[model samples]
Target chain A: MHGYTANKDDILKRLRRIEGQVRGLQRLVDEDTYCIDVLTQVSATTKALQSFGLTMLEDHLYSCVADAIAEGGDGARDKVQEASQAIARMVRT
Target chain B: MHGYTANKDDILKRLRRIEGQVRGLQRLVDEDTYCIDVLTQVSATTKALQSFGLTMLEDHLYSCVADAIAEGGDGARDKVQEASQAIARMVRT
Candidate 1:
């Protein structure tokens, strides 16, 4: 099982909410809503996704990375590297 | 009409694509995909959403905000302030 497996339901719930937000954005656009209003919604949606990513990242560190570190092998270093790369990608986004 | 009026189709298309990406994330989690893989997809989705937000913001600046500025009144100042606040929100996200 993956690090997020335990929180799968929570992760899916967040994604579903984000999906709904995106759909709302489309509705606003279809109705010719003001640009600033739409942009505000976009920011809210992005924040939600960012929050979700942080939760997942924290879980990965606590579960997967911790396991690797406890095992005392090169896998610990590799996992840390992989997590850092994921973080970099997140930051760039 | 709003700043995004002309690009309504494009904006809606981007939102639809984002919605699809969010759904894909749900699928990945439900299927027990690896944590890093899911996180990677999350980053991609965030980037797409940010790109969409930037396009909408640019349109607002070129159209609504610009129109207000061209008119040269208190409204122009208000519009600029509003847009700046939106940008701040986006940056925070």
Candidate 2:
């Protein structure tokens, strides 16, 4: 079972809301919204998205990576290695 | 200069502080601190770390990956492809 299983719907819903927030911010630009206000909202939206992203990453590592580590086969080894690179990308970024 | 150039140190410092915050949270647990308070602080720290990670990712896409894409070579193609996987990991997380 995936760790993301429990809150998958909730996370997707939140991301959709954020996507709408971003589109609204873009429209604000088209309509010349106040720079500070738009920027403020952008910052908030960015933080929200990042929070969401982190939750998914944490779950992936805890569940998928740990499972791969425990399984110990050719496929499992590949999976674990790929997960490492994924993690390096996440934190290196 | 790198994409992480301008704020590299600052970001690292923030991460270090967050690490400290995490340790503090552990201590809170050890000391039997209020569950809600510890959880709240943990959430904040996680969000902060994620936000920082996003900044670095954005910069990498804008500068490093873009540069690799703009150039032409086996190395450049490999770099861009690797970056794609990295971004996929970030969002697919």
Candidate 1: tens digits of C-alpha lDDT, residues B1-93: 878898889888889999999999999999998889999999999999999999999999999999999999899999999999999999988
lDDT of 1 at A59: 90
Q: How do all models score by TM-score?
A: 0.98, 0.45
Off by over 4 Å in 1: none
lDDT by residue for model 2 (A1-93), tens? 786998889988998999999998989899998899999988888778766766675566445644554454565446544654565555543
Question: Model 2's A-chain: what TM-score?
Answer: 0.73
Clashes by residue pair, model 1: none
What's the true lDDT of residue B82 in model 1?
Answer: 100
Candidate 2 structure quality by residue, lDDT tens digits, B1-93: 777898888988988998998998989999999899999988888777766766676566445644554453564556545654565565544
Which pairs in model 2 have colliding backbones?
A: none
Q: What's model 1's lDDT at A92?
A: 90
Model 2 earns a TM-score of: 0.45
Among all windows of ten consecutive residues in candidate 2 chain B, which has the lowest summed lDDT?
Answer: B63-72
